[model samples]
Target: MVDVFLEFMLGPMRAIGDYYFEHQMLFNAIVIGGALYKLASGKKRHEREAENCN
Candidate 1:
Protein backbone atom coordinates (compact mmCIF):
# COMPACT_ATOMS: atom_id res chain seq x y z
CA MET A 1 0.00 0.00 0.00
CA VAL A 2 2.52 2.55 1.16
CA ASP A 3 5.10 1.19 -1.25
CA VAL A 4 2.74 1.52 -4.19
CA PHE A 5 1.82 5.05 -3.17
CA LEU A 6 5.42 6.05 -2.69
CA GLU A 7 6.45 4.51 -5.95
CA PHE A 8 3.81 6.49 -7.82
CA MET A 9 3.93 9.72 -5.84
CA LEU A 10 7.65 9.86 -5.17
CA GLY A 11 8.59 9.88 -8.83
CA PRO A 12 7.31 13.40 -9.50
CA MET A 13 7.70 14.46 -5.89
CA ARG A 14 11.33 13.39 -5.94
CA ALA A 15 12.02 15.58 -8.95
CA ILE A 16 10.64 18.61 -7.15
CA GLY A 17 12.13 17.50 -3.85
CA ASP A 18 15.50 17.17 -5.54
CA TYR A 19 15.29 20.78 -6.65
CA TYR A 20 14.22 21.84 -3.17
CA PHE A 21 16.94 19.77 -1.53
CA GLU A 22 19.55 21.12 -3.88
CA HIS A 23 18.51 24.64 -2.96
CA GLN A 24 17.83 23.89 0.71
CA MET A 25 19.36 27.15 1.85
CA LEU A 26 16.45 29.07 0.31
CA PHE A 27 13.86 26.80 1.90
CA ASN A 28 15.55 26.91 5.29
CA ALA A 29 15.96 30.66 5.12
CA ILE A 30 12.30 31.17 4.27
CA VAL A 31 11.09 28.78 6.98
CA ILE A 32 13.31 30.27 9.67
CA GLY A 33 12.53 33.84 8.63
CA GLY A 34 8.79 33.18 8.52
CA ALA A 35 8.96 31.53 11.94
CA LEU A 36 10.82 34.48 13.40
CA TYR A 37 8.38 36.92 11.88
CA LYS A 38 5.43 34.90 13.21
CA LEU A 39 6.99 34.82 16.69
CA ALA A 40 7.69 38.55 16.69
CA SER A 41 4.26 39.48 15.39
CA GLY A 42 2.57 37.09 17.83
CA LYS A 43 4.12 38.97 20.74
CA LYS A 44 2.52 42.22 19.62
CA ARG A 45 -0.99 40.91 20.35
CA HIS A 46 0.02 39.94 23.88
CA GLU A 47 1.75 43.25 24.40
CA ARG A 48 -1.35 45.08 23.21
CA GLU A 49 -3.48 43.24 25.78
CA ALA A 50 -1.01 44.13 28.50
CA GLU A 51 -1.12 47.78 27.53
CA ASN A 52 -4.93 47.70 27.73
CA CYS A 53 -4.53 47.19 31.50
CA ASN A 54 -3.15 50.73 31.75
Candidate 2:
Protein backbone atom coordinates (compact mmCIF):
# COMPACT_ATOMS: atom_id res chain seq x y z
CA MET A 1 0.00 0.00 0.00
CA VAL A 2 2.34 2.70 1.25
CA ASP A 3 5.23 1.24 -0.71
CA VAL A 4 3.29 1.38 -3.95
CA PHE A 5 2.36 5.05 -3.43
CA LEU A 6 5.91 6.01 -2.46
CA GLU A 7 7.39 4.29 -5.47
CA PHE A 8 5.04 5.97 -7.89
CA MET A 9 5.59 9.49 -6.56
CA LEU A 10 9.32 9.14 -6.04
CA GLY A 11 10.02 9.07 -9.78
CA PRO A 12 8.82 12.63 -10.46
CA MET A 13 9.78 14.05 -7.09
CA ARG A 14 13.34 12.72 -7.39
CA ALA A 15 14.02 14.73 -10.56
CA ILE A 16 12.72 17.94 -8.99
CA GLY A 17 14.74 17.35 -5.83
CA ASP A 18 17.88 16.73 -7.85
CA TYR A 19 17.52 19.96 -9.84
CA TYR A 20 16.92 22.00 -6.65
CA PHE A 21 20.13 20.81 -5.03
CA GLU A 22 22.08 21.16 -8.31
CA HIS A 23 21.09 24.81 -8.82
CA GLN A 24 20.72 25.62 -5.11
CA MET A 25 22.85 28.78 -5.38
CA LEU A 26 20.73 30.17 -8.21
CA PHE A 27 17.63 29.64 -6.07
CA ASN A 28 19.23 31.42 -3.13
CA ALA A 29 20.20 34.40 -5.31
CA ILE A 30 16.68 34.72 -6.74
CA VAL A 31 15.15 34.76 -3.26
CA ILE A 32 17.61 37.35 -2.01
CA GLY A 33 17.10 39.56 -5.07
CA GLY A 34 13.33 39.52 -4.63
CA ALA A 35 13.62 40.51 -0.98
CA LEU A 36 15.93 43.40 -1.78
CA TYR A 37 13.67 44.66 -4.57
CA LYS A 38 10.64 44.64 -2.28
CA LEU A 39 12.54 46.58 0.38
CA ALA A 40 13.77 49.25 -2.03
CA SER A 41 10.34 49.72 -3.59
CA GLY A 42 8.66 50.00 -0.19
CA LYS A 43 11.08 52.68 0.90
CA LYS A 44 10.47 54.69 -2.25
CA ARG A 45 6.70 54.43 -1.81
CA HIS A 46 6.92 55.68 1.77
CA GLU A 47 8.94 58.66 0.71
CA ARG A 48 6.46 59.54 -1.99
CA GLU A 49 3.52 59.35 0.40
CA ALA A 50 5.30 61.55 2.93
CA GLU A 51 6.03 64.15 0.23
CA ASN A 52 2.39 64.22 -0.84
CA CYS A 53 1.23 64.80 2.72
CA ASN A 54 3.68 67.65 3.27
Candidate 3:
Protein backbone atom coordinates (compact mmCIF):
# COMPACT_ATOMS: atom_id res chain seq x y z
CA MET A 1 0.00 0.00 0.00
CA VAL A 2 1.05 3.59 -0.42
CA ASP A 3 0.86 4.14 3.33
CA VAL A 4 3.30 1.36 3.94
CA PHE A 5 5.69 2.72 1.33
CA LEU A 6 5.43 6.23 2.71
CA GLU A 7 6.13 5.07 6.25
CA PHE A 8 9.15 3.12 5.14
CA MET A 9 10.59 6.09 3.21
CA LEU A 10 9.63 8.78 5.67
CA GLY A 11 11.03 6.94 8.66
CA PRO A 12 14.59 7.07 7.41
CA MET A 13 14.14 10.58 6.04
CA ARG A 14 12.84 11.77 9.40
CA ALA A 15 15.84 10.28 11.14
CA ILE A 16 18.20 12.01 8.72
CA GLY A 17 16.40 15.31 9.19
CA ASP A 18 16.67 14.98 12.96
CA TYR A 19 20.37 14.23 12.74
CA TYR A 20 20.99 17.21 10.46
CA PHE A 21 19.08 19.48 12.78
CA GLU A 22 21.09 18.26 15.74
CA HIS A 23 24.45 18.74 14.02
CA GLN A 24 23.71 21.56 11.62
CA MET A 25 26.78 23.61 12.48
CA LEU A 26 29.16 20.70 12.04
CA PHE A 27 27.63 19.80 8.69
CA ASN A 28 27.71 23.38 7.46
CA ALA A 29 31.34 23.81 8.40
CA ILE A 30 32.32 20.57 6.65
CA VAL A 31 30.44 21.46 3.46
CA ILE A 32 31.87 24.97 3.29
CA GLY A 33 35.42 23.81 3.95
CA GLY A 34 35.18 21.08 1.32
CA ALA A 35 33.87 23.55 -1.26
CA LEU A 36 36.66 25.99 -0.53
CA TYR A 37 39.31 23.27 -0.80
CA LYS A 38 37.97 22.11 -4.16
CA LEU A 39 37.86 25.63 -5.55
CA ALA A 40 41.38 26.47 -4.42
CA SER A 41 42.79 23.23 -5.76
CA GLY A 42 41.06 23.63 -9.10
CA LYS A 43 42.41 27.17 -9.50
CA LYS A 44 45.94 26.00 -8.75
CA ARG A 45 45.61 23.15 -11.27
CA HIS A 46 44.51 25.57 -13.99
CA GLU A 47 47.41 27.87 -13.23
CA ARG A 48 49.86 25.00 -13.47
CA GLU A 49 48.40 23.92 -16.79
CA ALA A 50 48.68 27.47 -18.11
CA GLU A 51 52.33 27.61 -17.09
CA ASN A 52 53.01 24.32 -18.84
CA CYS A 53 51.34 25.62 -22.03
CA ASN A 54 53.47 28.78 -22.04
TM-score of each model, paired residue for residue: 0.72, 0.75, 0.75
Residue pairs that clash (backbone atoms under 3 angstroms), model 3: none
Measured by TM-score, how close is model 1 to the native structure? Answer: 0.72
Q: Candidate 3 lDDT (Cα, whole model)?
A: 0.90
| lDDT assessment of candidate 1 | 0.87
lDDT of 3 at 34: 100
Candidate 1 lDDT over 1-54, as tens digits, reads 975776687876767766887999999999999999999999998999899999
Clashing pairs in 2: none
Q: Rate the local accuracy (lDDT) of all candidates.
A: 0.87, 0.90, 0.90
Candidate 2 lDDT for residue 4: 67
Clashes of each: 0, 0, 0
Q: Which pairs, if any, clash in model 1?
A: none
**Pairwise TM-score winner, candidates 1 and 2:** 2
Residue by residue across 1-54, what tens digits does model 3's lDDT show? 976776678976776776888999999999999999999999999999999999
